[model samples]
Target: MQTSKVEIEVDTQRIMGTLASPDTGVPGVLFLHGWAGSQERDLQRAREISALGSVCLTFDMRGHAETLSQQRYVTRGDNLNDALAAYDALAAHPSIDPNSIGVIGSSYGGYLAAILTSLRPVRWLALRVPALYRDADWDVPKFSLDRKDLAEYRSSIVSANDNKALDVSRRFRGDVLIVSSENDDLVPHAAIASYRSAFINARSLTSRIISGADHALSTPESQKAYDSLLLGWFREMILGAR
Candidate 1:
């Protein structure tokens, strides 16, 4: 396998990424890490996937890890922009087969992946515990005084609901696989229900809940399970004999 650092221009900002490809030709898989995560944490997964005849591109989201940004988690739209920019970067890679692209996102990254699938049709999507909800249900942290700041948060909530995976399910023309934990604390069970409802309607989705797993699913056993499930799902959806 070979690895290289890459950068892509997104609007005025430049996003950093790492590309891992095997010596022989392979399909392309883009892995988006959670908030505060870097490609380093996903190197193991990338290597595993690359060994399975797929190139893996892992990147730091804007304002996270190596891709530093001025803005924090100001709004959902900000995250959407980052995801789209990453997608564009992956799509433009010279060695990647544009039509065989797939995405795997975890936690916050999962939410972005779900939204991106609706915006851009891909071969497959593997979302690990994606969040889907409106403002009324979400526990948006409050640490602002000015009305404009409060308004931005509220507007962000509204925008999130309007652009939810449920509402955009019909637009996702590819197969989807969702992996969630029964004991997740950060994301409520209701969010999983919402995702299921939407995916069920789409009729091109598969899902699994790891017993006793937490939000991060970081336990050694849980990580192994997740890695196996992700690998199988991607192989079936993107590289299998169809």
Candidate 2:
């Protein structure tokens, strides 16, 4: 496998990443990590996919890694832009097939990936413990806000995330896999339900709930299970016969 460190500039900001390729034209998979996560989390999976004769890209989102130190702004839209740029860069690679691109996102990254399908040509999507996208109050950081203040603020922070995710499912003619932690505490039931309902029009859809797992997959056993589920689904859905 051939690995390369890469940096892509989106507008004035730069997103750092890694690319691993077997120098094959089979397909390309992009890995999007959760909020506060770096590309290191996806490195092993990326290499495994690369060994399987596909190209893979794993990148740190804005307000993350090197980009975090270089910039002060971090928003969902900005992350989406970074993803778009990364997609373009990967697709442009000589060994990659532009039409055969897949994405795997976890938590906050999953939310961005959901929105990205509406904007890009993604053939397959895998979302792991996706964050609550439709609730702005849930996503944003609350430092010193009191209970009463938080409640009032939450009420006013209207979001179209549900609609956006639903639109992607309705519009994107691709395969989808959603892996959720059975004991997750951060994401609400409604949020997960919204994501499940949105896939009504997907060509293919698969879902799994990891037993005794929380949002982080804290235990080694749970972590192994999550990785296996994620990679196995990718093998079937995106890398079929490759």
Candidate 3:
């Protein structure tokens, strides 16, 4: 497998990313990081999936990582645009099967990924601690978002809870996987249940709770388990590995 850095422009903002792919054509997977994470955080998963005969694209949102300069300039809507643009660019890769694109997102990324699947064509979906999903319960700091942006985020969340993401996901009859930690303090079981209820017509929805993991899955054993579960889900659902 080989890896390379990439950047795609969504209007003025640049979405920075790392792309990994085998030496042949294969499925495509995109990785989205948590609220304060960059594309590099997902290198391990991208490498593992690429080695399994798939191409992976992991990128930083407008306000994080290599693109930190844009932090104060972007909003939740911009984040959605960045994700959609990333998928459009990734799907066009010569080594990727456009129709077989899957996505894995942690925390903020997971929430965005779920929303993306509702509006886009995603073959498989895997979410980890998908955070701030209920916009009604979330608030962007005044330093991070203006009143207008906050209104938009809250509105999006209301849409999400009203069956926008989940209902839109009904168009995708592929597999879905939701992973949560047993002792997560930030995202409770109720949040997980809400996400599950969103996938009303999924072909399969597999939910797993890490026994001793925290919201971050900090323990070595917990991290290992989380990694294995993600790799396995992509291997079978996206890569078709036996």
What lDDT does each candidate get?
0.70, 0.76, 0.77
Best of the candidates, lDDT? 3
- Candidate 2, lDDT over the whole model: 0.76
TM-score of 2: 0.86
Residue ranges of candidate 2 with Cα displaced over 4 Å? 70-72, 135-162, 239-242
Better of 2 and 3 by lDDT: 3
lDDT tens digits, residue span 1-242, model 3: 88888888897757778889989747889898887688877898899988888889998888887767767666666788889999988898898877788899897788788879867788888989875433432234313534454333433323333654445554557789999999887667766776776677788999999999998888899999999998888778764532
Could you tell me the C-alpha RMSD of candidate 3 in Å?
Answer: 4.2
Task: Between candidates 1 and 3, name the one with more favorable lDDT.
Answer: 3
Off by over 4 Å in 3: 134-163, 239-242
